[model samples]
Target: MKLRFGTGAILLLAGLMLSQPVLTQAQRQRPPEYREIMQAGRMEDPLAKIKAFEEIKQKYPNSVMMNSIDYLLVSAKIETKNSIDEVVKLQKDILAKSTGPGLITDYLTVNDQILRHKKADSFNKQKLVETIKKNAATGKKNANDAKILDSVPQQYRKRYLALSSTFDIQLATAYILAKNSVQAGRYLATFAKEGGTKDGEYFFRLGQVAELNGQKQKAFNNFFRAAGLEYKGADTKAKALYKKLHGNIKGFKEMLEKKLTELPFEPKHFTPKTKWQEKTALVELFTGSECPPCIGADLGFDGLMETFSNKYLIVLEYHLPIPRPDPMMNPATKRRADYYGAQSTPTTLFDGVNKLGGGGGKGNAESKYNEYAAEVERIIEKAPQVKLNVTAKLANDVVTATWSANKKLPNTEYHFVLVQKQEKYSGGNGLKLHKMVVRDFTTLDTPMKKTVLFNLSQSEKAAEKYLHDFEDQRGFKFDTIHNKIDRAHLKVVFFTQNKNTKEVLNAVICDVKK
Candidate 1:
């Protein structure tokens, strides 16, 4: 329960097994052990699943299920709330016998594990250098291969490489920790060139590396870029660094003012132009915890929610690996992000048509609130077509949830999404307590307006697993969730989308009380 950073989370494999051959009735039924293993394969209580995997392994170490069960065990071990040394030993044992994607991914994670608990010994430094080299070589090969990845399967397209800063930042840190200044300088320079001028953190870090390497010109340029971004801390850091490196900082600040006018992102035209003004609006907020620019963007969105949510709005925050790994990273969220062409953190997709990128304008927080407030006011000016209501009740291990639509929708698809209102996991930027997180979702394709029932078992963990690519960074684990959900902050969101256009029509929220 005390797992910090990326602990106590494992990959859910239920959906992944679907890509293989179809299972017969008997094969599907299998045995009690298979059923038990599948039940514990989610994120609610990883310790329980870890124990289940251990039981299965002890009884049937040589069973035909060893390959599949071994994977589950490895993933569960990563998520187990145990000591770090114990984790290192277990990972080393798995690495000795594992093969294919599992082995490679485990190796990458294990390398980080070693780094996480590294000592001052020269031997530890050598091990870290070796691991860093291995992760880079393997990651590069996998990045270039056109085939489907066997380990992590997040996006089908090559768009994932766009978020390379996730690993690049960690790699550069490892080199710096090892005191390999030459390698650190080289990798950071390449990161700056390939990452371009989009991410402020990348530019800021590049400036630090450049300054350390005595590349004042490169450092000044990168620092100036960071100063133009929305984050005040990064802005201040860039200003201080610029002054340190150059005697006359006043001249640079003056020029930066003019340069920011012609910034990287132009004013995008994302005005809502729906045929019918819908009162109940759904905003798919795609964000990353580590992204500094996201701080302003999130604040702008939250401002709207604080005032407008009571009137008519349902905000669904989808966490993804934009600039870093987030505990709430889900395959479904990533797919939804890709579907909407969400390339960067703090990308807000409103009602599936109005897509806005970047944080709010560079100004005070109050001004930032006004920046997105107008958009929300426009969305809720009129009532929606369907008035959806949803509710959930728990009894023992069973969760009985029901949803109803106010109007008939023969052509629209209804999706019932169960969400965790808030969590205690603070991401890279110290933004803990993530809200409106998608725990699990169900869909009814092309359905008419009617009351529907959905049942969930707390013991079943595989019902909501979505595959995603993590680059060996074992993403936030757990299933769609059954019963281990924090009852206090649990809510259900109802969304109705057009079957043909795929545009979300309307949405409603119902907070559940246990």
Candidate 2:
């Protein structure tokens, strides 16, 4: 022991000592490779982090990191697409284990998603119903099942209660789908009292359930209440449904009241006016064949025309230029449409007055037609405002018309229109059919205010200029308005009087179909 060692032996011992490795306490306590994935997620590259987490899961399947990796995957899926199918599966996977904090948030999120996309034939609905029933049974069995209660933390107890209320609402909806109004109504009442964020939907469900149960007044009340709520889509649906139903109910009551009120009233006796020429009625329909609803009104109008076919009842169909195929559309019609402030389809006029802005539907077409017919019958049987005498001639393509009123006219606008009738034309199924179309119109301008005499000399020149500009700008050729006698088929309509006053003293429908 006291003797000195050889140099070679000393060098070999030193080399062996240096070869052995040693680590500090701090280095030994460092986090594992899985932490890098979480760090990447905190740095905002969630997809990349997800991929890295998946790799960690593959490498260490049984490690504690697997649970967190699964949660992150579920969260990523939900955040990306607002989907909960994979999240629901993940929930089922961890249902046995006591999931840590934030588990309630996930559970509620998945439950809401299931309710949102539920369909009658979907497995999600069936699974949800089963789970709800199981939970209800278990809740009744053990009032203090820590396993169920602890699914959510104490800090999130209120959220769990809100979610429970939502579950009840969904259960009510399921009952509604099953046509069980009693259970649905009972649950709806409970949901309303619970006061959840989806109160609008709850009240709307209540209204629907009440309607199914034949409680109309209750349904209306619930619908009105739901409409007053702040839910976006649901509130709109409730309001629209309520308004429609209310309108129907009111209309029925008014009809009964009107019949009762009219029972005691006697019909007025018909008396003719002193001047027969002054009594004339004009019916202008601002319509288009392209409008489906307008077609129904047109059919009703056709029936009226066939029934009345008198010079006193002059019907003019002005085809408007809408974004659709309208072979009947003419410049005169568009001018008339613009004059009446008709921004909507199927506008109608009775005696130069706008009768309806947006005309009635097919269901109400017959009633509206009868209304107009009755008014015309009253006017023809009574006195007229003014008398109109007119003469029209076509030299080349230009039409010249001179009109004189028997009485002093009101300070109102008047228009002159040229119409054409089709005797034989190509139509549906490649067959020849007939049509009536307006060709041109002269704007309302008079040299003398409220005078009986008027001339188309100046108006004709302006109309020609306008037509020329229109054709040049729009690249569409139109039939000449200067002379029209050579066409062999044409009619002139002298529409005299004001639009706002509903005064149409005289109108004539001539058949020039060749």
Candidate 3:
């Protein structure tokens, strides 16, 4: 998934999560020269910034901030629309000079950019292919070098390992572009041996390579695997190939689903407990219907709901028309997204505080489920500061939700939301069913009474206006617009959270009674 920040600091190096290294006291206090060099990079004029960065490099030939300066200089040049060849050369030069942690970062950045540039018509394909081949050899060595791995922070070592495997896939892709399927297959084999990649694109490419090698069965299997992972066009290709091979696609989906289960990763299954000791945890997910990367997160959320009961875990999902318009998005969902400062899809907050972002393709659903399950399990162990109970009744096209907390602490807010049990929509993403989708909500800083009435028609009307305003702001119309709610499939969710800390003390979810 694409990682963007609003109120939190997080980084994703090609889908591998890496936390920022905590700065040491001495490193936090940088030299005056370092500040000046960084200031030069912040110049408004791109040309001037490039010049300043170049001059600073010359002035401080041995400065510890050389890597930072080099990155800024290259970024400034790119901002000026410099030729891709020139950018590659500059990045390669930096890679040649870098060592330790800088070497790994520069290596990954250089290879990744080169891989992307090779796709464009502007690049010198032959030379670029050679460049990647040479870098791949050296990068593999450096990645395994004890000194280089030691230089990276403990938290980032796994990310480095993941990057090395992804680089091998990039190299294989370059060879395939050069029409050298034999060499591509070799590198692809290495990638497979190294636990494979989370990216569906490479798997699709690998399937193409298998086809070129006349491995028909291998190609069919890989293509089906790619489709199951949510790679675009793979599904069509897989179905056509299945018909060609088996004379018909009688059990294509069933076979593919079975094959996906054979993967090394499996969704975590939790045993249901008959007793409770602490407050139930709430998992609020902010996602987009058109987001392809959110497939894994969406599936993971479904897995969690099936694995745990509402008595122990309450899950809420909010949709947004991010990157593209989503019919499921409502005004209340947008407000919750803005309140959390969520700028990316597939962002999950556990108990209103612990935020985890970034997701992969459908093939990664199980692993993502395990990742989320671990965090929710950790939060479930904590004691609740305040107990909460909620009940709802539907009458006369209106829903009355009454919630009460054992004690209301200062600066605490209570949120009441109406959620649809499930909605079926064919979005850009392949997900056919969305569960626990938030329809509308209301909040109180301090409630004189515990009962809140929600007018279903009014909420739908507000959502319709929100969708219209959304289209106006984007200067285009959505493919489809839906603002109606399934009243019969509605549920009520309530949670008590600290206004300042954004922490949920307790929560509850129950079906809306008729």
The per-model lDDT (C-alpha) reads 0.58, 0.50, 0.75
Root-mean-square deviation of every model:
14.6, 26.9, 8.5
Tell me, by TM-score, which candidate is best.
Answer: 3
Q: Worst ten-residue run, lDDT, model 3?
A: 1-10
Residues 1-514, candidate 3: write the lDDT tens digits. 1111110011112111122255467755665577777588558887898888888888888765555666667756655543556767676565665656555455556665555442344566687678777777777777788887876767557656665676677677778767789988898888878865544666677788988887778888888877766567788788888988999999997877765444324545676343455588899999888997788888888888877778789999999877688988998998999999997898899988888776666756766787788887787777789888889999999999988887868888889999999988878876777889899999975667889888999999999999999889989797777788898899999988888999998889889999
| Better model by TM-score: candidate 1 vs candidate 2 | 1
* Ten contiguous residues minimizing lDDT sum, candidate 1: 1-10
Number of the top-ranking candidate, with lDDT as the measure: 3
Error of 3 at 393 (Å): 1.4
Per-residue error (Å), model 3, residue 316: 1.5
Mind giving the per-residue lDDT tens digits that candidate 2 earns over 138-224? 332322345544544364343334444554565676676556788877776775567543334666677879878877667766655
Write the residue-wise lDDT of candidate 1 on 291-403 in tens digits: 75566566565566666644366788887777776656655576677667787888787777776555522322233455566666577766677776677765564455677
Rank the candidate models, highest TM-score first.
3, 1, 2
